[model samples]
Target chain A: MTVLATPQPTISASETGTETVPLLEVENLSTEFATHAGTLRAVDGVSMSMTAGEVLGIVGESGSGKSVTALSILGLIRAPGRVSGGSIRFQNHGELLTKSASEMRKIRGDMISMIFQEPMTSLNPVFRVGWQIAEALRLHRNMSKAEATERAAELLERVGIASPRKRVSEFPHQLSGGMRQRVMIAMAMACAPKLLLADEPTTALDVTVQAQILDLMVQLKEEDGAAVMLITHDLGVIAEMAQKVAVMYAGVVMEEADVGELFDEPLHPYTQGLLNSIPRGHSRGSALKAIPGIVPNLLHLPTGCRFRDRCPAAHAPCGKAEPPLQRMPDSARKVRCWLHHPEPPK
Target chain B: MRNYLLKRLAQTIPVLFGISVLVFSMLHLAPGDPADLLLGPDATPEAVAELRSDMGLDRPLVVQYGAWAGRILQGDFGRSVVLNRAVLPEILKRFKNTAILTAGALVFAVIFGIGIGILAAVFHQTAFDSTAMLVALAGLSMPTFFTGIAGILIFAMGMQVLPSSGMYPARGGDFFDLLRHLVMPAITLGAVSAAILARMTRSAMLEVIQQDFIRTARAKGVSERGVVWVHALRNAAITIVTVLGMQIGYLLGGSVITEAVFSWPGLGQMMVRAIQARDYPTVQGGVLLIAMSFVFINLAVDLIYAWIDPRIRYS
Candidate 1:
């Protein structure tokens, strides 16, 4: 309710691709884990806005906290890790952070649902796959058992699994890895939420299956008219599916831009290095350009820019302090770099 | 499921044969003359030899074993040397007494052990968890005989609310009286197994609650209670049952010390008395029955495990 008035969507020549009405607005979100050694700030001051029906991909390396940010939006962080400060406004539901646990439960798997990375371990093994799919319907929609079972079968068919009725009663272990992921998708879409949060949805699948899952997710999203917040480390996936992409590093979003803009002219050095690291057929003779240095430990992050130690263009100013995310001059893109913001934190 | 059950049952035959042979040989091989124990040390050699020959103890070792094994295969456990009564009937009567105590203990252990374990795992690292675990540790270390004696003093002697020993009061007693006598013995006997079950259940549940499926359950908007009781507990059940099944094997062997302390007329007490007098038939019969029950209980546990996990059944 305390949201700043969203400016009117101006039909511009540059095609920023964010002119649609906003569906999710996350403002200065911070999530921290209290470990034995110290507090680990996994996701800090992350802000992003996604319009309805848009697929916004958040891309980062393993420990860059992209997964944590998605978990924060869904109120899914468990013990030791908590959403320390944030405001997540989803559609007309108001501030998600202020909602009680029960209230949040009502929203989850209803207006917003999530699909995790490992489908093999994601579904309860003892329960039938259909029962798992039907569970969300029973929880949020209060569908009767028979009704939910019918819906579950239809969902399986919709996800391109043949002979849904027979597959419905089968256990997760009986299914292939690709089939299990499809079942997970069916479970997520059981209630047909306005938003879907998929964290590395295809990272654990075969190469061909990965492409199929990606295509199926996009196709289902289009058919259902639900926006997707895809968290992944694959730039190719983002290029193929997302309209806007956010590149994250060490718990902060380093750059946010249109997917095409990111792949064509990455504003941040980290993004530039990530794109260059992709080993292509034509560049087989030359060695790949991998980003230097390792991800800093979250508990003991340096005093300045997180990417500074590894950034090829690091200078004296980059060591002093971190830079804020600011809008680029010509388009609806943002970057957090000393080159982009010479004044630094101030 | 049928195939698995049948397979488990068939596999018990060789195991039963081995157990029977061990039981028969162990009692017979022990250094003791049944006739000497029967007659006093003052008995004449003529009388001792006459008694040994009369009892067929003078027969060759292989012949005696063959006769014993043949009679046992015909469902005859022979007669107790001391009591001069049928060993099968005597053991059966004693087994009934032991079953009552074991059944009561099973109820107590399941209710308190699993309940506290689940609660402890759910509230792990909290004061309740620490306190419950500490109590379980004490329960495990404390012997049943000591607990049974203390329980007798506290509840039977001092309070005068319960019978001190036996399946019932000396005079004819009702079912209520039987229960009154059973309370102390059951608690004392079950204490150790309950502690073991609690530890197993806690660790199993802790492991299951950390699985991705548990997170999936949470994401589905399942209540916290449902997430734990339904999802986590179901996954933990196989491990918990394996421990419980092993405990049943020990339980059937009878809580010997607890029964003795309470003066309960169970097979453990009978076996102890029979052994004191070298009553070979009674000792062999009681032990063989217990070993057979242990095998059957293990089979039952395997069936339960197969039921809980489909992978085991289908594979």
Candidate 2:
């Protein structure tokens, strides 16, 4: 493990206070679920930021709170689950967490939109594809129904659906899984949002279709100059698309760095384990070096480091207290491991 | 869609036939002969026997059913022995009254039921939700007669706000007067069905709100109202409409109690009087009409199902 041997300055120091604002800045975001057993601090004090047209991938195992963090950014958390603490600043809108519902409504789908995992269930089954897409247009842009319908048809064509006019009138069930996902993308991009929170957008699609969706997303992001917060468990997806990467485990950021550096020289033990576990054809004969224990249950997490039990490099400090995410001295990376203890906050 | 409707209509033939046979057999199997009821107690056994043959009640069960079935096919429902009137015309007159009462009650049921149901679901886990659901539960279990009588006692007798019983035609064909008397019966009959519809709507809304599209809707900045009302409710409506159709069917049969309690002069009350006097033709004709109406209502509901969901139409 390089462990940020040569520390470098992160992007935020110079980026903030500049004339242009970074597309998104999520600070100290803490999400919790009020379950029957107990309160689960799902996303515990996570902080990640992105710039316009940038792709920031949040990669984690199942139940690691990556999706929860994305939902927090959108203020989309439902009852029994909530963003207990956070300030999500998007473009110029200050502290989205504190925005009134009506204000939030104005920002949602217009300035910030979302694409979900299951395309099959993500589109309303009853409505025509044209009407569904037109809905976003009408809500945010106040476009007349006729204009929105015509624009929806154009969007369908843009998403590569054949015979856009005909497909626009068809129901969601009439489309294939890939086509449904394309429709979802069209709806998400209808308003040309500045930031798109896509929680596993291609996870439910076939291998062949996943590439097409990823490519379409990249093209759309480039065209609109929109930032993307891509939440996925698939590291390959992150490597293929993201510029920066944040590795989350047990509701906290274990490590974050430029995508290339994070993949090549992982600083955190958890990040190393995650990267090593990916199946490779060259290593076919050897058994996969799977991560040691399963994720800790959020409701009854261990007293010290949440991943301590599962961590291979766990030691005395790991048992005593959980490590706060410490920024490296000269590196543009952050890790919440005890070995890289930076100056404590005064 | 047309083919599907034609197929559905064809299927109803068997169902209607079965209901007719059941209605006919049930009346015949019951004790108390119609001839005996028509003739006085002072009449001799021979006189009763003469009346039985005159009324064609002396024939075998199969022969009697065939003759009655043939007449019914020819649009002759025979006549009411006790009422001394043609069965078809008397039932039709009362049918109009019942139709009005049912239509009035349905308007009340659908409006309040769906509205309150959506409110309860959107405000789920709140005091309004709990209380509304509780009232809905009561509505579901409480019989129509109980509510009908209670409405009369409270609104008519105690408050003197609305008339207690009967239609308005006797009081100078006053349309508003009919409405005044209609208030209690409509509410009483509609309450249970409303509760049923409300409960179905609440659960359906609750389920729909949890779907992935609802979250997608919120993420896209659709207002919370639009999310719940537009996106979630449209999906929930699929289930809600199915139950509403069933409620309409069940309410038709249940209207009997409500009509009798208020003496609204509808088919249900007439049927009650007919059953009491052992009027076989009126009872049989009324039952057949109700059974057929129920089937047709369900058919209408199925079409509505297709209309609400594009998925259902193709299947």
The per-prediction i-RMS, to one decimal, reads 0.8, 0.8
lDDT, candidate 1, B1-315, per-residue tens? 799888888999999989978987876678767788789899999999999998778998778778888999998998998899999999999999998999888878888899899999999999999999999999999988888889899998899988888887788799998998899899999988899998889999999999998888888788899898988998899998999998877776757887899998998999999988888889999999888888888888898898888778877
- Cand. 2 TM to true fold: 0.92
Q: Which residue pairs come into collision in candidate 1?
A: none
Give the winner by DockQ: 2
Scored by TM-score, the top model is 1
Off by over 4 Å in 1: A1-21, A342-346, B33-67
Tens-place lDDT per residue, model 1, A177-263, is 999999999999888888999999999999999999999998999777789999999988999999999999999999999998889
Estimate, for each residue in A49-92, the C-alpha lDDT of model 2 and write its tens digit: 88877899999999999999988887888779999997888878
How does candidate 1 score on lDDT? 0.89
DockQ-based CAPRI category assigned to the predicted complex of candidate 2:
medium
> Which residue runs does candidate 2 get wrong by more than 4 Å?
A1-20, A342-346, B31-67
The TM-score between candidate 1 and the true structure equals 0.94
Following a full C-alpha superposition, what root-mean-square deviation does model 2 have from the true structure? 5.4
Winner by lDDT: 1
